[model samples]
Target: MADSADPSDTSKAGRAGERLAGAVKKAAGSVVGNDALRAEGELQSEKADATKEAQRAEAQAEQKREEAEAEARAEELRVERERLAAEDTRQEREERAEADRQTEAQRAEAETARKQESVSQATRAREQETRRDEVEAVRERGEAETRVRDEEARAEQARGAARTLEKVEEEQR
Candidate 1:
């Protein structure tokens, strides 16, 4: 449902025509020296002028409204873009923090591994030292047992020579 009168055309031409007719009538009345006709024509012209002024005012107000609406829409878009940018910045920071945390965890794990390897190497060195000590002690014990057996054999030979000498002397006597 559209109105027959379009808003774009506010009938300024119609008001102009009325104003011309009133001017013509006023000039004819003045030539004839008719006071009433001249007065009526002047009033009509003034009325037409007032109507034109009112229409102009209305158009200006409508333009202002449209401009205000456009400005509001632009402001809304700007605010939305700013919010999205802030969210993007926050997300980027969170991602970086998470990456840093993961890197730190990896570093800690590597340090723990290094420490464990050092402890393992120390334990291995101690076991080797203990094994060497045990071997040396066994060798020393074997050497001591050999010296004791040699001394016992030498003592038994000396006792046998003494007994044989005593028997020879007794037989000679």
Candidate 2:
């Protein structure tokens, strides 16, 4: 099997070779007093440094982006919890209100039953009063009839006594 070279590794090796060549040129230019060759070598070195700094900055930016994403997820979870808590509070309020309504209904029913009981008691008392009045009237009528019969008997006895006295006076004359 043939080994395939990775493109990223090839690029990194190429950069390293260029840096070595630049260093050699800088040393040769310094020994030979060639100003242009020294300047070219310096330019190559600066380019490598600039490329490394740019890569570092890019890595830092990626890390910052990842941290921001994590923080956003945490905030989302906190908001979800708050929403659930609010829902729970609303349901509890509804349950309490329903319980209060049921209690009120029961109270009203009890009040109605009490009123009915009071009416029933009043009716029974009226019936009792009517029975008492009927019994009193019957007793009064019996007493009046007995008094009339006694008065008639006494009048008849008085008439008989008067007749007897007249007969006795005639016999004496």
Candidate 3:
């Protein structure tokens, strides 16, 4: 691949180099009848493969997180659109009611009371919808955070395993 500034690209190139070097070492060891050198080369190639797999898994997790966040934002926008539509409807009703009150002065008090009740109901409904959206957003954020933590834990485990293998190789040497 052509050189790029992306870290993933760098990592991919590095891993490829490691595998190539490992193959060379393994071949040289074989020619010299050296078991230790061959073993080390095998370990190096395996480590490179493991790191590549881990990076792939992490990229997948990050994609999933981005997708989830996008979904949440879309939902919030939909809710906001609905709320605005509702507000417009409420405003239209209020305007019509006001016009009626001006013509029917005898029923003005009752109309005002009814309008108050209608406004209260709309307010309560809006509050409930707002609360529900907030809860959903919080839940989505928590899930995304959990996924990130899990990925981190997996990466750490891979590192630990690599370190343990290195220690064993040292002991063998």
Candidate 4:
């Protein structure tokens, strides 16, 4: 029977045997009609049972407390993991936002450069057109001056010819 009995059960049986022995001793003293001894034996049995029950209740309470602590630790770890994950997500979002901002800035800069280039090209074109107009004006003025000089020289030559003819008739007469 000892070989078959679990250690915890054996310990409980040993405590029970001790309680039984005390009760038997009190009962034997009461057999001669000693009422006090019988009453004392019953009281002792009640006390022993009460003590055992109290011990059992204490063990159960301790076990429950340990289980509660384990559960609390698991919950805390879960919350921490969630917090870390949220932080990572927030960081990722911030990085993406920063990248978007950079891209927008670059695009705006490129647009501004393109506009400036167009404006510069237009300014150059205007300057070239103005120079061409000035050259044309100068050429037209030179052509007009040449025409006026040629007309004056022709008139002087005709006057000289008429004067020579009048002198020659007068000499001949």
Q: Which candidate number has the best TM-score?
A: 2
**Each model's backbone clash number:** 0, 0, 0, 0
How far is 59's C-alpha from truth in model 1 (Å)?
Answer: 3.0
Q: What lDDT tens digits, residue by residue, belong to model 2 across residues 1-173?
A: 11125322323334444454455556556655998887876676555445445544564565567557655765665565555556667778566556655765576567557755765675566456445534543454355445544655677788888788888998889
Q: Write the per-residue lDDT of candidate 1 for residues 1-173, one digit (tens) a residue.
A: 11226443534445445555566556556755888887876886676656655655675575567557655765665565555556667778566556655765576567557755765675576456446534553454355446546766787888889889999999999
TM-score of 2: 0.42
lDDT of 2: 0.56
Q: State the lDDT of candidate 3 residue by residue for 1-173, as single tens digits.
A: 23345445545447665665566556556656898887877787676567656655665666567557655765665565555556667777566555544555544445556655765675676456546644654454466456656766898999999999999999999
Q: How close is candidate 3 to the true structure, as a TM-score?
A: 0.41
Q: Tell me the lDDT of model 1 at 47.
A: 65
Please report how far candidate 1 places residue 116 from its true position, in Å: 78
lDDT of each: 0.60, 0.56, 0.61, 0.56
**Residue 173 CA displacement from its true place in model 4, Å:** 99
Candidate 1 lowest-lDDT run of ten: 1-10
Which sections of candidate 4 miss by over 4 Å? 1-14, 90-173
- In the order shown, the candidates' Cα RMSDs to the true structure are 62.5, 63.7, 21.2, 62.8
Model 2 lowest lDDT segment of ten: 1-10
